[model samples]
Target: MAGFIEKKALKKFSPGEIICLEGDAGNSMFIIKSGQVEVYNTVDRREIRLAKLGPGEIFGEMSLIDGRPRSATVRAITDVECVEITRAMFDKILAGSPNWLGVFMNVLVERLRIADKKQRVTDSVEIGKKTVYLISLMLEKEEKTTGIIYKQSWKKLVEDISFLLDIPPSQVSGILSKLIFTPLAESEFNYKDGKTFIVKDWERFLKFTRFCKERYLKNITKGIIEEFEVKSEKEVKFLKFINEILKEQARANDIEMEYMNSKCSEILNEDISKYEKVISELVKSGILKKAVRDDGGKYILVDLELFDIKFQKYVDIELFENILKKFEN
Candidate 1:
């Protein structure tokens, strides 16, 4: 499908050069026509060799569909010769071949289905962003067993959780103290890594998060459905207003007017009219301010929160906390 092969673009891999890193989005699959490569990951402070690929074998195709991050790092074991099949080329080739297309599509679909299932399961888990890793590591260590929330030596708990979250020990201790009042399981266990929280509360927390996600999805669907149902006279006006604002702002900022479409898509979820309506309301309420630049352009800048630079005090901790709690619950 790559009708024009640019030979100049092809390059050779040197020894010890990292072919690909774990968690990198794979844009292409490569066939090792010659030499070798090593795949590995770190677990429990140990480097575990996952696999070694040799000549004539292919790798990294799993990410072609959803462009998922690589599960393991691949390093050149020796000088290697590889031919990369880019995602676009791969798709084109598959599309032209009915038999192969069906096979490839089925494989891609199955892979994505599995990935989605696993992602959904992980998303349903409850714990703070950083702290969740600690809980997961603990659960894994116990051989797929549940957690027991035990109160013990704060010093060791801090050290363990800190390592898990890649934060300082003191910070771990502080976070754990805040969570102590929350529900935890009281399970009996040996002191392998200080005190462990073997709490069954993880399930309840997961259920709550799943419920919130469902409600959020429903609300979004409702909004989209309502939008389609209503007449769009106001929407048309708002879109025109947004286009004008974008042109004015771009000229003021010395940016390309062509970027307006991209910026509108990013900030307004591609709903220029709705974004304009919101901005207009804010301006009418005096919650947002507009400035006219020397280049005959206007820019709107909103002051979201007040801050005291000298004392490092924020004006709305409660508001920020509530927003965070919305995500947490």
Candidate 2:
């Protein structure tokens, strides 16, 4: 069976060699014409055996179908001879046998089903981002409806948030419905396009999340990696926002440099510099300005207005200001 493979396609593997690992791009299928290969998965730092394959058995057949990750690790158990069928060959075979289209579809569908399990985790995070984004949009719509900001329709709002969050319109709608239930709920509008839920009191949501963030700021900083678990981008942005507020509050209170650091540590239960660095970068970028305190504080005075301008580019101004107020005490 191994000899059935074209000489050009026949590949050999040495014992103990890793033929492939999980999450690698699938490109080729292998038919073990000789020798043996072991399959395993790593979980909790332990190797769990899947199975072993010997002569005439095929591995990577699924890879040929879906072009997804290998899903498991395979290592050569002994010097081996295997026939490889690449994605190109798989397509060529399909072209010649359109009658097998249903077979290919079934294989691809099964691969997708397995892949969806991995995607559920990804989708949950995506849904979380969508939740944040929809809330942000709801704030804008509320501000406009109340004449605080420019007016925009719910359809347009959904479209904009969907594009920014990189999620489907349907997912955005589902999340928006949940968001509308809170004091954050503004107005509900149904149009030919779709339904939109707006936030009525932006301040309520802002203050609530801000209070939540501040009350948990200590725990948030300590267990942040576990709680309110945010992505690196959001974490960085949030840290920067908090740091700028701390700097401003320090300056306004005329707190000494040593005192501000101590105060920050007390409030967030963490050193201030982690956030200080982020503010320093913004200052360097001219997005934020810095001033020195005559009180002889080692920390730089971060300009809140400058910080607000920069942050407004990434998040809502009202939301930013509310989140920053958490550090005021």
Candidate 3:
């Protein structure tokens, strides 16, 4: 069957070209005819190589068989040639051969892969601790600079931590809950305003974070190969968009609230009313100050130092300008 497929015209890939990305719809499998390809999964924004396949190996078959999204990304390691087999061709070939055994084997391999991934995540105690420590540091930075940590800030913090630590946001949330219960830190939850503030015991919390770093540095630093939990890329992009706008306002000292709302709606591709609650929460938490301008227009002011501390790394001047281009009149 492999020889039969290789007899057909093969697709070529340049070194370093992406063949398929994780989470993309997968309808075909590739049978390597020459050169090499690397398979990897992205965790915490870092790529973890799974395997390097040379000629005669297959990739992307699991997704084709299961009718699911690609679980990992594949890229060319060297100039490569592969025979692409679509689902139609796969079915036609299976129908003529004693392929029930092949189907069963593929199913068994996929199930084992999933189970192994689950076991790895369950065993990653040091990774979980390091994630909590990072979140604590972020909270401490926000509190010391802004005097209050808003609900929106917490949402962004969790997302950022998930992206950085390559863990699920739910896992990060569980770690945060445990940290809040610890004696090293105290939190004040404003039910009315939907904000949580780390109002007490800052020094102790910082010390705890330092302790985690010292204790878990070795295990955390050791590179471990594991399947990455996928997250919604759009949500991450949206959070970055919000941070970019806030950073601009922080730098300018003040911005017209109407203009801010319009830009947010444009980026979100939704009505500003959808985010009124979030804006209100920001105001209630003191991250954003709402005031009436002398000319009777409404505006919001941000603390420049606090904003810089929170979003310095997330800002990209080129990306910001390109996003703003769509809103230009």
Judging by TM-score against the true structure, name the best candidate: 3
> Number of clashing residue pairs in every model?
8, 4, 1
Every model's TM-score: 0.34, 0.33, 0.43
- Evaluated at residue 309, the lDDT of candidate 2 is 48
lDDT of each: 0.54, 0.60, 0.65
What lDDT, from 0 to 1, does candidate 2 have?
0.60
Report the lDDT tens digits of candidate 1 across residue range 137-250.
454444434243323445555667766655556445545544444443343346675555444555433433333344445555654223123234453344344445545665
Per-candidate alpha-carbon RMSD to the true structure: 18.3, 17.3, 18.8
Sorted by TM-score (best first), the order is: 3, 1, 2
Best by lDDT: 3
For model 2, residues 1-329, the per-residue Cα lDDT tens digits are 23445576788999999988877988998888889999987754556577999998988766657666787889999999888888877777677777778576767769676785656554544454435545554555454645433233666666777677665666555555544544445444455535445544555555445434443444446644232333356345554645565656763622345665676676667675767665566657664454465664454444556655454434543443343332222
Looking at model 2, residue 192 earns an lDDT score of 53
Mark the regions of model 3 whose C-alpha exceeds 4 Å error after superposition: 1-3, 42-51, 99-103, 123-125, 132-178, 181-329
Q: In model 2, which regions exceed 4 Å deviation?
A: 1-4, 99-329
Q: Could you tell me which residue pairs clash in candidate 1?
A: 147-198, 147-199, 148-197, 148-198, 148-199, 149-197, 149-198, 185-199
Q: Higher lDDT: candidate 1 or 3?
A: 3
**Poorest 10 consecutive residues by lDDT, candidate 2:** 320-329
Q: What's model 3's lDDT at 157?
A: 62
